[model samples]
Target chain A: MLRIPCPYCGVRDQSEFDYGGDATVNYPALDASEQEWFEAVYLRDDPKGPHTELWRHARGCRMWIIVERNTVTHEITGARPANPAHAEVLKRDFELETT
Target chain B: MGRYSAWEIIKQGLTGNKGWERAWRDPEPKARYDAIVVGGGGHGLATAYYLAKEHGIRNVAVLEKGWLGGGNAGRNTTIVRSNYMIPGNTEFYEFSLKIWENLSQDLNYNVMMSQRGQIVLFHSPAGRDAAARRLNIMRLNGIDGELLDREQVMKMVPHLDYSENARFHILGAAYQPRAGTARHDAVNWGFARAADQLGVDIIQNCEVTGFLHDATGAAIGVQTTRGEIRAGKIGVAVAGHSNRVAQMAGVGRLPIEAHALQAFVSEAVKPHLDYVIAFGGIGHFYISQSDKGGMVYGGDLDMYNNYAQRGMLPVVHDVHECVMQVMPSLGRARLLRSWGGIMDMSMDGSPIIDKSPVEGLYLNCGWCYGGFKATPASGFCFAHLIAKDEPHPAGAGLRLDRFRHGAMIDEKGAGATAWHH
Candidate 1:
């Protein structure tokens, strides 16, 4: 079983969290085109290596956390809040370091 | 390939079984061919066979990165069914069922296709109504499907938990009498041998690294680990690696994700389970007793996009919980082994058998968890498209651009999410 680290509630069992899919998506404006919205909703990347995904602490503190994990190895590299303030900083740092 | 018959078996018995030849030959990769299949699994081998037998294209090569049937072809739970409700899928799967009916004779090999039947249990009124609608659609399509009431389900599978206080109490089920399991490895071997006999080269341990395109940007060949080989046409049936292979040909992202789907088997015991049974309640658990008496079963995907051919323990626990809830007696059966296959979950939960944007390049992928059952029709239709440059009637609706045009064939009505399907 995976032990995911929730930013608000420390590390916990994977069953306590509900998967929320890719965390890299940026929702378009309310008046964005249908194509843009469709791409944003449906055209998500499925990379083979490390990925950042959203996981909700359903059975715990009820906070959305961005968990940086490896899809192939299932390794937890980092975790932080999915709140915009912290999420943007983490994502940018991840992209910069990886690139 | 030598003809396999009872007479041959008797003759071999008399000769101490020494006259048997190898099922297929391990041939060296040629420098060029009329057509090349980029995966030596069941679909690619069958595509090569039909391309030679029906399309009169004898010079074909099937390149595999590993040994034949080493991928998802031999990794699935092996349950075969045609109980789909959608228009395109129902006809296509029914056509596959028909092909499977005579597959052994057609390929001159015993595929061991069993038709014990399949029962999908529904636990609630809403579930029953939805199953009724799906069954009506099946009946309309001339495919067999019967709605079984509580007593009928109890009669069919008496071992199931039927107590009034049981979790997810049994309400009814949809039964498909012609649905069953097949010997997955035998299917792959049979197709490879038949295709080899029809003058197709079956090259193993050869991986395609890149594509060869002409000035017009049409794919004409591939660069493999062995070497570069030219072909008139190239068909990619690389299952979970569909997006990876497509990238080599300059075809970017696809509406597909590779997720690990795990299956478990219990230790062999006295025969008890006679039919393939699936739960339609909260969790996605399906179980069937193998011919060897082992209970082969599986549940939902691991709910992550990973190309690794392995899954997590959470899904394993989820499956065990569901199985124990349905059949309490199975709680005593110890699990012997567990394995996972990379499923190419498409956005619409249906397959994509169409021509790639690059000319002369054909694709047969996005099979999700249903590829094993659709092997025959997937090959037949893909070969037709590669040969004629047009979609086969059975696969006409499975276009790659469906997502862009909002023509998605979402069978489970799960919208566009890959893992939900």
Candidate 2:
């Protein structure tokens, strides 16, 4: 099982989380063209190497996080909170714990 | 090899079994062909066979990166069923069922197609009602279906949990006596040998690197590891690595995500489970005893986008949990082997056997985890599409733009979640 290091809940088994899908997608405007909406929502590059994706700690802290992982080897390298403020808080906590 | 028959088998046994030639030739890749099919798995080989047999396009070549049946062909649990309810999916799968009925005879090979039957257990009355609705539709479509009560189900499958205090008590089941399993490897080689007999080339170790397109923006050929090969038409049936091949062909992003689905086979046991069974509650799990006595089974996908032909440990727990939940008697059965197959999950939980945007580039992908059972019809319909340049009636609904058109065949309403189905 994958040991995802959630920024809030630390490392946890993958069963404790849920997949959220491609984090690299940039949703078009609410009034965007139908084609744009279709492309953004349905189409996927589905690369063979490292890509940023989303995962939710559904059973842990229930926080959505961005994860950097490889699709080929499934090697997780880093992760951070989805929200900028939460990421700042996580960085501060790491610095304080180290000091 | 000559015609395979009971007489030939007995004669071969007497003649020291030296009469049989190679099942298929390992011919080198030709410089050109009338049509080229990528991926020599069950679907690809079947497509090549139909192209030669049905369409009379004998100048065909099937290119395989590895040996035949090396991919999902040998990885699946070999469960074949056509219990779909959706309109677009129902006809296509039933057509596949029709093909499976006569596959062994049609191919002149003993595919070992077994019609032992399959049952989907329902735990609650409401679940039974839902299953009843689906069975009603199947009957309406002229397909065989039966709604068995708890008593009948217990008599048929006595090992299921029937106690009143059971966590998920068995109420009844929806069964299709025609649904069963087939030998996966035989399906591949049978199609390969049959296609070869019809004068189609079965080329292995020929990896397609890129597509060669004309200035008019039509695909003319492919650049492969064996060298450049030309073709009047190109069809791709590489299910797992379809998106990668599409990228190399410059088809842009497909509505597919690669995910690994794990399957397991336990050590041989006594022949008890005659019918394939699906767990009704909780996680996705199904099991059926193979002819060799091993219990072939599997659960849901690993719930992530992955190209690795391996799975995580959590699904091991998830599958075993359901196994013990439904059949607690086999708690001590040791797992013999486990493996994974990368599935090309589309936006909708269906397949896409249609023409690509580019001319001469036919796309036969998006079979998802259900491709194993759809092998026969998928190849036939794909062959039709490639030859006629129009979607076959049975496969007309499996278009690439169905999601954009808001016409998804989303059974169980899993929506866009890749792993949910």
Candidate 3:
């Protein structure tokens, strides 16, 4: 079973989760041609290596998550919300709590 | 005594009554049993029932952690077929199909075993070749199977948008006439009641903690939530949680991983699909329109192993994309609901029904979403192994060492491409 990390319920068994395939698909613009729209929606590149896929927490919190997984080893490297693109790099001050 | 009909028993089994709840709250078995089968799903209960009905072993007990059929059996899409690619698998599953035919009458329950036919579409030439090999094997094994052209398939499933412009190009398919989906919970309840009537004790909400062993390294009894109970033999029919149960027995250390598989249903609409369809190029998206006028579908599992219930959006989207491609009109159908269930995926994508090194301990696991189809045959084979202390001819080659000996019966060729295929 996949170790799916639910944003609300933390981590749980894959039995309680659903899988979403390739996460890089983008909808075509409104002004695009019919062929372009078809290509955008129907075409897909099923990668065999480390790919960012989509997942849902069916049993726990109902949140959409983007899971970066190695399809070969069934190892999940990272996870985040279903963001289409990365945010701009920003500089931030690091705070450390030394307890 | 008011004789309860099969429907009444099924209703009580699915929607537990007040008595059912009270009995489950404090379940206590008889003083002793000749055999104890863990996991009161289809296989466990079927084994218990068959042992009492066929083998005359009435002193049997079926232990369930939760309600009957609440596990994978309830969660399965309930597609039953024996059109396997190998002779051994094909023969075994064909036997299961026969049992499925007479199952309703035998159990005195209305299982609704619909033989609406099942077809697997192939998009690529490689897939076509593989399907051809499987079809040939099925035919050789005396199974009712055939290869249909694209036109034939389109005529059979009229709503299928098989135009060349479809997302996945129109291709021929392998059709099996005997394969069909059935009511999942009814089968479980039918077997449960049959076993109950045959003097097999059914215990619900009884979680098995560990196994009690004798000095000779033999499993004497089980440690459960209620108390200790001895048995002459034991069969572990727990599919998804096989590894956990095997670990308790100190055996079954293979490259088996527990994965969560998901299924979704669309809102009830006019019935469109009449047959079960499978897409080979896609992620094994096998689907069928249910009796409720909703498309009941499921696909391969998520890539990781975790006990989380909810699935990711990408899987749902991809699965919907495939469905929409086959029948573009369904693109507007709203998804009614989705659910997930655990599957014990072996490295070879096959099951292991063999006696372990542990004496008196037997295993029938690693089903990988195919357990629902093999319930009857699996139960029969396991019970035979336990009763006669030998493997049945149908399940003789399904040994644990087949993986080590390089004699794997990789039906989907999962061994050749463990990562991708």
DockQ of each candidate, alpha-carbon based: 0.46, 0.66, 0.03
Residue A81 of candidate 3: its Cα lDDT?
69
lDDT of 3 by residue, B221-334 (tens): 898988887898888888877877887777635445566678998899887888999887655688898898988998767555534445655567677777777777888888
How does each model score on TM-score? 0.94, 0.96, 0.77
Better of 2 and 3 by DockQ: 2
Q: Candidate 3: which stretches are off by over 4 Å?
A: A1-99, B1-27, B414-421
**How would the docking of model 2 be graded?**
medium
What is the Å distance of residue B74 in model 1 from its true position? 1.1
Q: Best candidate per DockQ, number? A: 2
lDDT of 2 at B307: 91
Model 1, stretches more than 4 Å misplaced?
Answer: A33-35, A83-99, B415-421
**What are the lDDT scores of the predictions, listed in order?**
0.89, 0.89, 0.76
> lDDT by residue for model 3 over A1-99, one digit each (tens)?
457776567788776776655577666779988655544443234333576777766666655678887654567888876652321111122231111
Model 2 C-alpha lDDT per residue in residues B143-232, reported as the tens digit of each score: 889999999999999987788767888889999999999999999989999999999999998899999999988999999999999999
TM-score (0 to 1) for chain B of model 2: 0.98
Q: For candidate 2, what is the DockQ?
A: 0.66
True contacts kept of each: 0.51, 0.88, 0.00
Classified by CAPRI criteria, candidate 3 counts as: incorrect
- Order the candidates by TM-score, highest first — what do you get? 2, 1, 3
Model 2: how far residue B99 lies from native, Å: 0.6
Candidate 2 residue B100 Cα shift, in angstroms, is 0.4
RMSD of 2: 3.2
